[model samples]
Target: SQQGEEDPQALSIQEGENATMNCSYKTSINNLQWYRQNSGRGLVHLILIRSNEREKHSGRLRVTLDTSKKSSSLLITASRAADTASYFCATRGPPGYSTLTFGKGTMLLVSP
Candidate 1:
């Protein structure tokens, strides 16, 4: 079954602005991960926040996880036109499950 669903079907912003996207999941998860996809390219893993960790940052990316709410948010600071892409969140189900379920994704457009 699908586990994660991202909020905001789409987003549009200018370069240098900040873009934030959210994801909500249905089941308990061991960890949540964010990824970015450029056009037809493969997804690029951005950051992974474990259940035990509430927040994490990687370069221009910030991620926050609220286990009780079964939600997570991703923030991209100083966005650029190159940052235009689709963002997806993935969740790792409880133990014994080897696969991760990904959300539908939020399509972001950063205009120059």
Candidate 2:
């Protein structure tokens, strides 16, 4: 079994600042997705980028993928206190397999 590994295990920032996290995986993937989890809460899906796509964005989020390097990055612009959470990257296995492996996570803290 393979999994994604997130970087910068922890982070701290002030409100209105920006936050960025990176994820790396060992195997080929169908798609890579980002998520946000508040303390003791369920994960919230943020964005998804296919292996063939180089970049994607959703609102304040910017995601980039480099298949050749087997890595991806997530950037949150104008981050707010509410944006403080653990960000993660999930990798979906190829076509038929029903496996979705999640990276450990990058913790982002935004103070008011």
Top lDDT: which candidate number? 1
Query: What pairs collide in candidate 1?
Result: none
Q: List the residue pairs that clash in candidate 2.
A: none
Give a tens-digit lDDT track for model 2, residues 1-112.
Answer: 4489999899999998889899999988999999999999999999999988999999999999999999999999999999999999999978887678999999999999
How do the predictions measure up, each by TM-score? 0.97, 0.96
